[model samples]
Target: MTADGERQVRAILETRTRAFGRRDAATAAAGYDDDLVLYDVVGSFVRRGEDPTGRLERWIASYRTGIGHEIRDLEVTAGADLAFCHFLVRISGTMRDGTEVGMWVRATTCLRRQGDAWTIVHEHASVPFDADTGHAVLRGEL
Candidate 1:
């Protein structure tokens, strides 16, 4: 049962990642619980429920030319009705100014199972900061 749960949770993550890579904000948001809470890397405060969708749309829009997302070093654990996964995500694209943008961010997701479907209830994405310089550390290993 644990293995099956893990597989299911992984499938959800995969689908969500694919949706995000395609810049399909609606499909990506569908994987999240209606009352989802997110601590986003780019934002200063926590985002609740459907608020992240607006941020996502703005982000996709910023990459006016093209965008690509890659997930790496994913690890997942699942129980009966709960699961958690963490991974490194790389987002690369061309910005509207014709400059290339690329970043590596760490992400963690907590999921809850409702009936047979798993939905993300909590998610956090962050990039390490250089304490001395007060700058984000964007380049790193997975």
Candidate 2:
């Protein structure tokens, strides 16, 4: 990818992270489509609704209170105006009752260009493969 394309991809994702970590639902929702889809590996969630901003806010709040994800690596593959971003995420933090929680997962996001901007069209997220099972067991049949 060209440097500018790379920057655009990173900026898009960073905006999402900032929104998520700060519990800014509006910002987070901007990264996705109006009819966005999300699957949570940890919560076993398969959700499609009118608005997903609320869910983004709630996820951030939960991260601050009990759990959250850290972006370990983000690889963006771009084709013309489209991008497929692959993520390695680490889940961590302690709950209110002091429960330690930590794990790693893999996520995928499909983005499309909207004029000079970009937005997510489809997203499929999941946990990494297990050493024993040698298969992904998080979400979306990874």
For each candidate, give its TM-score against the true structure. 0.89, 0.74
Global fold similarity of model 2 (TM-score):
0.74
**Model 1 whole-model lDDT (C-alpha atoms):** 0.82
Question: Model 1, 44-116: lDDT tens per residue?
Answer: 6788755656767787788765467778888898999999999998988888888797899899999999999
Q: Kindly report which residue pairs in candidate 1 clash with one another.
A: none
* Ten contiguous residues minimizing lDDT sum, candidate 1: 48-57
The C-alpha lDDT values of all candidates are 0.82, 0.70
The most accurate candidate by lDDT is 1
- Reference-based lDDT, residue 111, model 2: 78
Model 2 segments beyond 4 Å from truth? 42-45, 63-68, 129-142
> Which residue pairs collide in model 2, if any?
63-67
Candidate 2 per-residue lDDT, tens place, 90-123, comes to 6666654566666667788887777877777777
Clashes of 2: 1
